[model samples]
Target: MPETSRPAHPLSADEALRFTASRATETTFFFDFDGVLSPVTDDPDASQPVPSVLGVLEELASRVARVAIVSARPVSFLRSRFGSLEHVDLYGLYGLEVWHDGDVVTEPAALPWVPAMAELAERAKAELPQGVYVEYKRLSVALHYRTVPHLGGEVERWGHEQAERVGLRIQGGRMVVELKPPVDQDKGMVISDAVLGAGCAWYFGDDMSDIKAFDALRAREAVDPAFFGVAVAVANPETGAEVSSAADLTLDSPEDVARFLADALPVLAR
Candidate 1:
């Protein structure tokens, strides 16, 4: 981990490890798929969890009471990626969707926003900067500006403008800007609901939107004295500092995340 990060407030690494070791099975794990489990790629389709990450998740799912992924990606996408991992819960589009036991559960309010989403997709192609293309997921749209690094700010500004016009909210993730319905769902709400009865909860992420989830973990501790939460931020050049500053601990990369999980098995087993 880099020594430059200024975490908002976090348990020391030793303290967090000791706490998790104290009550292994009572711990619930939450992770963001992109930049946490899988390295961020220029092409989203090219992204997949490293083999070590997949194996570690499989093992953790068997041992932990709950292991969930709450991400901006759609339920269908998450289902395809993590469906094989046993005892894993998938919440996509933040909390607007839930894919459990192979069934998809979506909020009713999201349906009416479909037409507007389509219009945004069209406009993105016709109006946005070149190399800044729109990825149309059925329920939402993501404007990717990764291939055109210099146009990031312009794409983001345009994304926000379009989202406002379409009455959708903007979720800023790695190298992309997502436009989705202004529903009451987000990573924060997802974690808040999932951690209800958990003795300890950990959320690992590496994006601007993930800060909300990190805050949720911290907030739960204030409400329940015995609740232990760990906010882990993965280091990336763009928003790594911000995420790390808000996290309990910072890991160097997806490889480190895999190693962390693989190494923690024994500690958790104890």
Candidate 2:
């Protein structure tokens, strides 16, 4: 079950954006890459941010105290897709690796997991279904099943078997299962760190894995309601139910996100 199973009333986008605008400089904004910024593609290789999204990110990065792109993708992939945005901090593989100002910093402790990830990737390539492909991220391995949705169960089982043998953990996302070292970091931890000392924060995401961040916001707000943490769900057919249920707000699509950011420009500018 997701951390926050019950749905809170959806936040009014207008009010939420305005709230963010009011504290623009003191707000730290975090976003999940795949579904929140890019249109989800069956082929991960084809996953790219909407043409206008990057420009919006650049704008927001300039206005917000900080902007981060936290994702399950590898730092290389995140760099390739979003490196041009110099001001944004990019965290990949759920924060085991981070890229900022052209330098990529990977957790030194995660180095030992490299060989196991490589081995699992090779094994998955041979053992998994035809449409199921493995992505080797050096410190982690992800089995993608978007092209073969029914293969999700098989992939999950195989991932579990490998994780136990390799001393790793399973992180499930939309039609994807990842094997990574049991790092203490997650999207929630990332959000917690990002919001430190900030007046307000907001996170936008579209997967069950993202529930951790929503729960983090809930945890924080429960302690101090003045420190606002808004959770925005990017509506999608596959994972919208759980994501929206946990989110304080829901946007229809990546295009809606782009529009939200675009509309937010004037608010922050003034």
- The residue pairs found clashing in candidate 2 are none
lDDT of 2 by residue, 96-120 (tens): 8888777899888888878877888
lDDT of each: 0.84, 0.83
Q: Which one is best on lDDT?
A: 1
User: Pairing residues by index, what is the TM-score of model 1?
Assistant: 0.93
What TM-score against the true fold does each predicted structure earn? 0.93, 0.92
Model 1: weakest 10-residue lDDT segment is 1-10
lDDT tens digits by residue: candidate 1, 44-89: 8777887688778889877778888888888778777876786788
Q: Give candidate 1's error at residue 225 in angstroms.
A: 0.3
- The TM-score that candidate 2 achieves is 0.92
The total of clashing pairs for model 2 equals: 0
Model 2 spans with C-alpha error above 4 angstroms: 1-10
How many pairs of residues collide in each model? Answer: 0, 0
Q: Model 1: which residue pairs collide?
A: none
